[model samples]
Target: MSWTDLTATDLVPLPVVLPLLAAGLALVFARRPRVQRVVSVVALAGVLAVGIALLVLTDDRTLVVDVGNWAAPIGIDLVADRLSALMVTVSSFVLLCVLLYSLAQGVSEEAEEETESIPVSIYHPTYLVLAAGVCNAFLAGDLFNLYVGFEILLAASYVLLTLGGTGERIRAGSIYVVVALLSSIVFLIAIALTYAATGTVNLAQLSERLPDVEPGTRLAIQLLLLLAFGIKAAMFPVSAWLPDSYPTAPAPVTAVFAGLLTKVGVYAILRTQTLLFPTDPRIDQGLMWVALLTMLVGILGAVAQDDIKRLLSFTLVSHIGYMLFGIALATQPGTAAAIFYVVHHITVQTALFLVVGLVELRGGSTSLDRLGGLAKLAPGLAILFFIPAMNLAGIPPLSGFLGKVGLVEDGVRTGGFLAYTLVVGSVVTSLLTLYAIVKAWNKAFWQEAPQEIETDARVPRGMVVPTGALVAFGLALTVFAGPLYSYADRAAAALRDGSYVEAVFPDGHDRGVGESNETIPKAGAPAGPASAVDTGEGTP
Candidate 1:
């Protein structure tokens, strides 16, 4: 269970590095969007391969790749363990689908033949850069490095979010950009405070050193980080921005935003809670309340919406509460449920969005009140939407059921009044989620339109491929839950113990102990009382 050291083969940088470089090349090839698509897909495929390889190589090892050959606690490094590798791998695939969906865009050509040129011709390249940034954030081992990754993608997202520069998109994006900037500033201030307190930015190093620090100071830093990340995760009170801005973007862009972006915020929270503040008592008493409220508020928002994408966006916000519920448990099964749900949500959410996009293309709008009877028109599109919506609502014989059952089981197993409240909230949210999806289906696909929903343009085969792939992945998660569970369990095991933190920096706090990065992946993952594995070893 003790993994001593890890090296490049173990900590391959392809997930981050390949995308980073390819983003620039994609920009270079923007004159030919098809070529840019090819380059981006190639880059993402590389990331996917490396991510899978790294997962196998990082059984128990904390794979670290020190940038510029500098030692930890002084120079920056990248940490690849079970959780990050899983996130990055999934992100790469999502971005790949986004790019593919983008390629078949006819709006550009449709507008090109008109008088004014479409302003957002650069969307493809910028989107790839944003993917690069997401990868960077997941792989980053240091807080500062994470900030850099965050900013990189945030900048690109602002561009992609406001692609058309329409007065409406600009107005919506203006608010989005400002709110996002303010949150980024909040994160920066917290990072500065942490660095001032510890004189270090490496998370692995902070994990090992923060315990000696005063509890009051640690709590302050933790709250600041939470506020910053919470806003981004769209958790309840700070989540209103998501429905407003996300629904305004073009369908493909919205799909990726739904599938990948908010999850980044949740991912940061998971890392912070598990790695930085695992032993905090308030997690049980107060955090549970936030999770419960988040789920309720989000699902409530979903029920009130008639726009399919907007409804899904609100539901996405609520679904995040499920992940946090697992995290609050701070147990192996709890974290494993969080991990499994992350993957399931990614595929299911993306497919639904892509289906919405397809509906938009065929029926010309996603509002249920304005559209109807699409199932009779395009049975194929109906099939795609049905599978994911049913899955999203946690129907049986699907991956969503597995994920929902895991969280519910974890909540019930950690029995108490608070656990009971969360368990009840989970059931209520699941029912509400089903009601919202069924509303969309009955009104948009099953019910008749007001004698207007009609379009002769075919949903192109190219446009269908990416969305179909997403649906297939969702079902595969159901059929292949075994291997997926094994990986999720391993990821949970690695997150459970501090074996990964130790392997990344073998000498621990002291730097001159002649430590060499080793190629051996940790033979076994570490396990302990999740509450007992505190990593706060930094300066007070």
Candidate 2:
């Protein structure tokens, strides 16, 4: 179909499909670096356009598409709501910029030496696959599809993480693969139990049936899902893999992984928490404690790190607690803030890692003891790093500060000893975050050189421009916070209300254009103000 002839439902899968198609074309053109670059860029740019269009289209409505036009509870489906739309848009922007940054890195490395450490033939296809996986996760409408998305990305990441085959990269990749496989196994078990209980793996269907399920069985399923998502989201105790695993990859790989991957996990938790089990306060309450501990532990680790990438990785985990803090509230304002925070973080964190890449290039190392006088050497780079660093530290008038304030206000309104304590923990984490960032700043940019730093290698303009564009995008969030926050509020309302469910099964029954012999059992809607089910009816 022509673009002009397509409906909103038709736009639902392009973000996932475009990348996979481009990945195949990229593989065919792998022998020609320029052709591969063009294909990758054009494909991601198309995805970015589609993502923005979907975001605008889904502003006031949720769109669902059953793959191959087959009915749900049997065939796979994709859903585009405000939450998923916003995630796709932001993640596409990040993915596009990181791709450009990596391309520039490759061109510059080739110019600098005879041997290229980054293999272009392997990089383009894998990166596009990574993009497809991320888009798939954001748009997935069921548990098994979500698991499929995770595996796609994990498989791509293994290749990216071990790109160089060096000892450190190999070791880090091994650790990462083991942890990811374990999480996948746990998630698979959770899906099995969910299907056995509800008779379908469709998320909208589960929202109706899960309430009638035995409370103990429901809780077990909820906790298992949380355990799996928590490991992926890198929540405290389970977050140990992130700091070590991320810092070993190429700077661009690390940037995208740190920026988009964990947030995908957080998005899963937010979707399932608010939609599938909003009535259950037991898990929400436990999430509050986990959020607090993750904040404290992650920031403490950040403060101790001298390597810039590892430091940023720890801070990445630390700031995730803020998103969790908002999710744990299970209120409209809290979720809106969490959604807003997710946007802020994806841009800011990715920009910071790209900047660190520049630092490594200019200074020959990422360690504080090995680097100094960067401000004098690269003033533009200094400005680039400083802006995002301060924003990350939550300085006034930045998106980070605004997002944190929203979370704190809601926490105070939540009004329990734990809520108040989380409020306090949020403040302390921000302050400690400032301390860690400032320490990195002083040591790397302002402190006297520990030795004579190499000044011959020029920081690539190709790399700097993309990095700067991302930094500017983060700043734009601060400028646009009012409208964006309002959008998030509406999105949160849709999640809290039954609008998402209503949109999926418009007549209160299983829906699609194709036939399914399988039947969805009818069940009464759960009794609660928080439940998002509108009808107890099921498809027959």
Candidate 3:
């Protein structure tokens, strides 16, 4: 169908489908680098556009698309509520910027006759696949489909992580792969157990059926899901793999991985926790402690790191605690803040990594001992790095500061010792984050030269422009924080009010759509046909 002819239900799958189709076309045109770049950019641009449309459309209702026109609890469905729509929009925007950044890097490398760490022939297609996977996970309406989404991204990531085939890259990728596989296995078992208990893996159905399952079995299923998603999110003890695995990849790969991947885990956790077990105080309390430890441990590691990449990696882990803290409160205000924080972090973190790439390009290394004098040499780059760094540190008037304030207020309102402790921990983590970022700033930009700078290695405009655009986008978040947070609040309310479940099963039965199978002629009628209606606008 033409773009104008497509309805909201038709739009649900495009975010996932467009990228996969583009990836195939990109692979076919692999021999033509320019064609690959054009295809990748256009595809992601289309996703971004679709995501924006969904974001606006989903503000008032949730949209669901059954893959084969079969109803939920049997056929797969893709969902786009405010939460998933917001995620898809922000992620697609980040993916597009990162693609632009990588394209510029490729051009610069070609000019220098340097051997590329990321080959364009493979990079474009693989990156598109990764994008598709991320969109899939966000949009998936069932547990098994979410698993499929996770696997697609993980498979693509292994290729991107080890693009150079260098010993360091391969070693890091191996560590990453092993951890990912273990998580996947745990997730698979959780799905099996959930199905065994409830007879379906569809999330809306699970929400209805889980409470009726035996309490012990239900709790076990919840914990298994948590363990699996926690590892993927790099929560506390499970987070050890992240800092080691991310910093070894090409800058663009590392940037996307650091920015988007863990957030997917966080998204899954938020969705399941709110939708599947809204009343489970046990897991929520445990999550509070996990949030506290994740914050303190992650920031402590960041404080000790001298490598810019590793330091940021640690900070990435540290800040995840804040999102988890908001989630653990199990309150609408808290969940809203968490959603807002996730958006702020994705933009700010991705921009920081892109700036670090530029720093590495100019300084010849990410290690503090080997880098210095950059502020004097490249003032624009210094500004680019400084903005996102401060934003990440939760400096006042920034979106980060706003998100944290909302979380803290919600925690105090919750009024418990653990909640109070987390409130304190959040403050401490932000301060430490500032300290760590400042130390990197001082060593990399302010300190006297520890080694000769790469004066000949120009920071190409191709790279710098996209990096600047992302930095500008981060600034935009601060300016537009009000409406965004309101949207998040609405999303949180919907999660709590059973609106999503209602949307998925509008008839109060197995059939998600309004029409009935009995309406058709038994012999000649197709078993399932795509639902023509919009599943009705969701109640917020």
Candidate 4:
């Protein structure tokens, strides 16, 4: 933590800055598809390298960068620690995977329609920019910086979602765009309200000032923020926009969306709850109710879908509820469970979606009725789909199972009656999710092929590789869960203390999370003061 030690190689700025610069360069070669691919891919590789460096170099400590030499609370900043770094690592991996898949897709589709292909030039450039946006959001320190990062990603997604411009694509993309834009607008409004009410947008400053706000004011701010983020995270009633929109995109696009977008929303909620309002005797119960509803509702949707992609989309929404449930539990282990679950979900969900796309390619459609006999036709594809599907269903010996165990155990230990009921609901939802996957397998692989169409023989090897990469990568998490969980534990501890503390108080003081109530306030009105938001995943 010396001044000279904080170079560009330092943890704080490199992850976001490298991607931003690379994205700009990629856009320069936007007209040249091949060049754009190289620049973007190389840039994302750099991001992954930087992310690894960030994780290794931190040693469970915080790396704070005060932008332009400004002190905390006044200057914009970035913090790279275990939580942010873990997210950065996962996102970079997912981005690189999707980028490769997209390249393969461009080649495959271009070759197929050589006579009249729809010129997929914009995809490479836009995708790189989108990746940068996601990277920025994950690492941002201040609220407005987070907003900028979100806008960058969302705008890029709007175009990517509708890249094909087909009737179905256009319709789905429009809904996605409208919902996202409105959510962004609401987010902006909330920022304005918070800023006007308390003169700082830096998270740490608000963490200090938020407790002093009137009860009515705090509730208003909290509800607006939750509504905005709930929309983004696709939690419960707000999640309707995800299913119709996601499945309509290209395979790579869908994978990235499934992997990154809602998770970003979940990340946002994690920050807000831990840093801003950890628990309110009143507001938290409301959030818990929403959490339970979101989990049940999403799985129910998943069960009802006939199309493979659509079913996964609903599952995505359902899983978000689980993450929120961890957040709602407001305990160290619960939060840790959430952190583990987020990592597990990103890899499992993306791998599963990619496998579905491959299955569709080989079979011509992902509908339960259209897909059949794939287990015999392509054993490799089956293996790829089977592992991740089991993981997603939370089967044993997988990271998914471990993450759920952590969360459910935490809930029962500290959550009392509400916690136990929700735990039951969570278990049931997991079972339902398993049922949906089993149905898909039975219809697509176990059952015999109904009708024959010889034109598109097997899913190309290119598509297979990217997906296989994800599954193999996901399996690594299971194998290495111990160290990763330790890191996640450290990360959960750091984040709940408020990431931008120096920005809030330039003296650079530390509040020794859960011990200092003088500096960090709890959830209440202007007059009431509670304990610091309990952010560690398992801390009792």
Candidate 5:
């Protein structure tokens, strides 16, 4: 379908618009927490529906919505092709589940009493705004708008991060805010440099113009963008902030941030690597090394953690290396594996955090030293935790295992010392992840309970239900791995084919005045060699 055919595709903007609108309405009803909760849940449910529709619609094509009738390379645009739509759908489902979990947990007595700092009334609205920001970032079609999306989510996150405003949370929030501000400032400077050099910040426009830039200048811009996004994605050397900041937040907040936030940064790297800087051997090699280090360092940290939340946070960083490993290969199977791994990791990681929240709810502490015998006290929670835990460790027949298998296969297929070394590192990381999670399991669920522990702590149905639902979803990804991987492969192909750019600029005007107005190759075309620039035009 053509761009004008978007008349039938108004659903493109609703994922972002609904939550933003609901956030405003929720704020107005903040005093009536019940009303605010209903509004926020309904809005997110609506977004979930829209996400599903967009995913189905864009499965074989692209859908672009130019905001306010503004044209491309100038106006804001929201584009949903296979990749973005899939991300939105998955993330929306995760957000809705976490929101349900939060509401189930209810406001703590301390939060209720600290009305000034906690502002219990604002939680629903701010949470919805956070959802809006995540949706915006995934759907964004240009650099400036993507930055806006980051700021929107980061602002909401700052509020969520310090929800109770206790001393510990405040301190954690302070560190988080400083790091986020630094990243944002760096991101903005990157935007300025990009626009100055290319005369446009629209990604499709950059795809055409960036190649004309001098090699040194292009590499500089590329590294700057990577540095900014790497911090956001919690890559090694920059990931120290995550373990410290995430564990202090309330469970639902931490879960959502853990699952979605870093992935957004990874998504940015995937998009820019393919669209803006498709084939640079040096960049590819650099990413491989970074992936190797992130895997090693992150998993080792997880191994040493006595706290379940912090351990999971470290594991979260470790698995990101798997995705980056695939991207660094810069091949179809590698990209496909990364996309599939992303879907797998988000669900499994978020589900694990939800289970951790449940553990804390029943056992009264996430500290492994204090908890024990949860298997006897809460069999349901034990089962819930066991499934995602094993999945996160890449245990057989689960989605995580499937994702890792794909990555390893791609690495071997790439066939070099670096790829082989990272492959080994990936295996070691997986084994270490298993060891850490099993250690938590033995301490928290299998071992004898301490006398001081509260055996009678209630497991509310609200909390159990969402956590169980997410676990089931993770299993569903495993059960349906064949189709999901196929979808990811197609999405990977589309990214390489530049179908997204064509969808945004259907008139081909953005390809520059003197350039040939050729369309991007179709999805099933033979993929080029790993070293060949997959930029359709083969300019490199």
Candidate 6:
């Protein structure tokens, strides 16, 4: 359908609806494995296309879909703007590629064996449900719907994490489920308190009302929300659960989780911090310290790892600090840099994990000691690993480098002691990430294989193609850095400007408009500089 024919509200729901419908179809065709694969892939691909369309259409405007045609504060609404659209689109593409890779590797086929622990018939359906949840979380316009979205994905993830039913997988699944459940409980409680305090769960309404709350109560709510999201984002001190949980799932499952799940939490933090709690010096400074420590501790953990998957997991946690660094800077450029890095990291990290899966297939293990001579055995896999690994390391001319540069430049421009310190920490973390990856490379691809280890047969083309595609996609981010950065800059600007709030509550009821102290620009208005200050107690 043409953009002229389809309104933003009409387009907003399709990304969530298509996968959910396909998931039901997948369940009905459970006995037909080929149909299941087709349904899952097509559903996700459709969502990806819809997300892209929404991104283009909503670049300059907000798309708000009120389910059941209900009005704001009482009805369920799905809002799509540039930020949500970008996240959903990029995540959908990653999910699709991972699905193709999983199918190619015959993971579902293997699961079908009576001897296997996971139910093969349920994989496709569950996967689609997970995708649906992800899109829902991205598009949700209310706190309750966002909470529901998290529960949906976490439920499906509990199933996916332990698919093989091996003791290791089961143990890992238990930890993941527990951590996820605990976070959900906290999130639900936060929702309850927010409603009790403000009498509305709609984000736009909350944005308008929350600032008027008592400072102590407001800070408490912000902390509760941050604590819940921090655990989900795998932030430091609360991040102990991630490395233990993620490495045990099947490669594709781990890849997608590593790529997208924590990011959803980061997205939540981004939305809430910019909208609900605009400028709290205390919270921003606290987050800065957390970011620095998360980076240091996570990369240190990675440096001590012997296995590639676990190593990547630690690095994954480490890089989240980079995004948090942007958030902590609380400036336009910093937020823009964080957005760019999120996109870069999602593709680069997912691709790296897929390459590790291939390494496992070729060398029989992901252990550095067990894996060697891969460059000679599977040159394509070596190249795949090399590209993303270098990108992840923040090597020059890659998207990772550009992202870091943006962040560092923001820090420099902001010129705070904490910001400057984080710049140094970020550089150190980048170098350490390179060291860890190079250690893996030297042992897995450069060094000679241990005679005791038996190398598997040639790597499958199915796996290689997807991995290479993601790697190429990451490079494309660099090749087209100008436009991509511009888009990210716009997204950050839109968010800081309160365009989302305007879109959700277009009637302008209680939006704090025309108040002398109001700092937030009206809907469709340009946001002021990040440095703009307002003494208005009621301003956002």
Best by lDDT: 3
TM-score of 4: 0.90
Against the hidden reference, what TM-scores do the models get? 0.91, 0.93, 0.94, 0.90, 0.94, 0.93
Model 3, 1-540: lDDT tens digits are: 223323766888999999999999988986788898899999999999999998987876666677876778667878888899999999999999999998988732442243454555777888899999999999999999999999999999998888767789899999999999999999999999999998889998899889999999999999999999999999988999999999988899899999999999999999999999898888999999999999999999999999999999999999999999999999999999999999999999999999999999998999999999999999999999999999999999999999999999999999999999999999999999999999999999999887789687799898999899999999999999998999899888888787677556655455433446322312211223322223234432
Show pairs that collide, candidate 3: none
Model 5 weakest 10-residue run by lDDT: 525-534
lDDT tens digits, residue span 70-121, model 1: 6565657777777887888788777787677767765334334432545334
For residues 301-367, write the lDDT of model 5, one tens digit per residue.
Answer: 9999999999999999999899999999999899999999999989989999999998998888999
Once fitted onto the true fold, the runs of candidate 2 whose alpha carbons sit more than 4 angstroms away are: 1-6, 107-119, 510-540
Worst 10 residues of 1 by lDDT: 529-538
Model 6 agreement with the true structure over 1-540: per-residue lDDT tens digits:
234424545778888899999999988997888899888988988998898887777776776776876656666888888899999999999999999999988876665573454567878988998999999999998999999999999999988888867788889999999999999999988998898888888898899899888888889899999999999999998999999999988899999999999999999999999988889999999999999999999999999999999999999999999999999999889999999999999999999989888888778898887878888887878899999999999999999999999999999998879989999999999999999999999999999988545545877888888888999999999999999999999889888786677666554455333333222434333221111111111222
lDDT order, best first, reads: 3, 2, 6, 5, 4, 1
Predictions in order: lDDT: 0.78, 0.87, 0.88, 0.78, 0.86, 0.87
User: How well does model 4 score by local distance difference test?
Assistant: 0.78
- Compare candidates 4 and 6 on TM-score and give the better one: 6
lDDT of candidate model 1 versus the reference:
0.78
- For model 3, state the Cα shift of residue 78 in Å: 0.4
RMSD in order of candidates: 5.4, 5.3, 3.9, 6.2, 5.2, 5.6
Candidate 2 colliding pairs, count: 0
What's the lDDT for residue 429 in model 3?
Answer: 96
Candidate 5 residue runs with Cα over 4 Å from true position = 1-8, 108-110, 114-116, 511-540
lDDT of 4 by residue, 1-540 (tens): 224344422556766777678767766765676777788788888888888876665553445565775545566667665677789988999889888887876742542353244454556657777877887888777789999988988888987887756788789988998998998899999999998888778777788788999878877888888888889899978888899999988888899899899999899888888888876857767777888899899999899989999999999998898898888888778888899999999999999988888887788888998878888888888899999999999999899899989889988897577888889988999999999999999988889878873544767677778888899988999999999888777777776665335323433353322433233232210111111122323321
Which parts of model 3 have CA positions greater than 4 angstroms off?
A: 1-6, 107-119, 510-540
Whole-model lDDT, model 6: 0.87
